[model samples]
Target: AQSVTQLDSQVPVFEEAPVELRCNYSSSVSVYLFWYVQYPNQGLQLLLKYLSGSTLVKGINGFEAEFNKSQTSFHLRKPSVHISDTAEYFCAVSDWGGGGADGLTFGKGTHLIIQP
Candidate 1:
């Protein structure tokens, strides 16, 4: 079974300040990773993903994350943040295709708080 751990439950940052959300996963077998952001009254949106190839993956809204196999970490970072960026971020890991029969594993999620 695979598991994800979000280092921080909440991250508070001023509007326009850079922020990073730490995510670490534990799995015995190979896996695909994903990062998703969910805003208030909205569904989860794909932020970035690491399937194969490059270790660093870029996504929409200037968000990016690097896949570190040795460290088993996929940290999400944004150079500059906005008030609209405040939301819940989730990290996921799946061993087989689309979670397989075991289902996908997910973290508790990290809530980003943007302050003015």
Candidate 2:
């Protein structure tokens, strides 16, 4: 079964500090990589995706991630985080070839705490 795992359940950091949310996946077939962010009662927004080509992918809100094929990992990183960055981040994966689950399989979730 194709699955994604986030290493951290929560990451606390002071305002303007750097942070990283680790994500790993195991899939027998091709897949799409994604990072989604949810703020409070709001819905999630697409941060970035790695469909094909390029190992390092940049995302919204000053965030980025690198896809490591050998390690089967895609870890999110932000050079500097702000208080507004406090939210829940989810790592997801979807079947690239279709016929599988159309929707994403999300990680448990990582609560990003940005303290001022």
Candidate 3:
């Protein structure tokens, strides 16, 4: 099993302003890290992921994350945020891939509050 930690429980940002949500994971084996966004009354949406190759990974809605092996972190960041971006973001990790039945250790979500 893998372990992850989200540094903050809430992050308040103004619309059109930059924002970052911190996440850290502990892995003893090769692992994949993921970021997901959950909107009100909606399922989780994939934000980004770090599997291999380059440390920087980008995803839908202009979200991105940099995998730092040294820091053991994959913090999600967006250059600018919209009021619609307000949601709960989560960080998760799994060793040994495949979507279904594969266990992913998830960290507590960070609520992103987009303000006008």
Task: Give per-model CA RMSD.
Answer: 1.7, 1.1, 2.0
* Residue ranges of candidate 1 with Cα displaced over 4 Å: none
Clashing pairs in 2: none
After superposing candidate 3 on the true structure, give the runs of residues whose Cα lies further than 4 Å from its correct spot.
Answer: 97-101
What lDDT is obtained when candidate 2 is compared to the true structure?
A: 0.92
Tens-digit per-residue lDDT, 1-116, candidate 3:
57899999999999999999999999787788999999989998888888899999999999999999999999999999999899999999988654554577899999999999
Residue 41 in model 1: shift from native, Å? 2.3
TM-score of 3: 0.93
Model 2 segments beyond 4 Å from truth?
Answer: none
Clash totals for all candidate models:
0, 0, 0
Worst 10 residues of 1 by lDDT: 95-104
Indicate the TM-score of model 1. 0.93
- Which of candidates 1 and 2 reaches a greater TM-score? 2
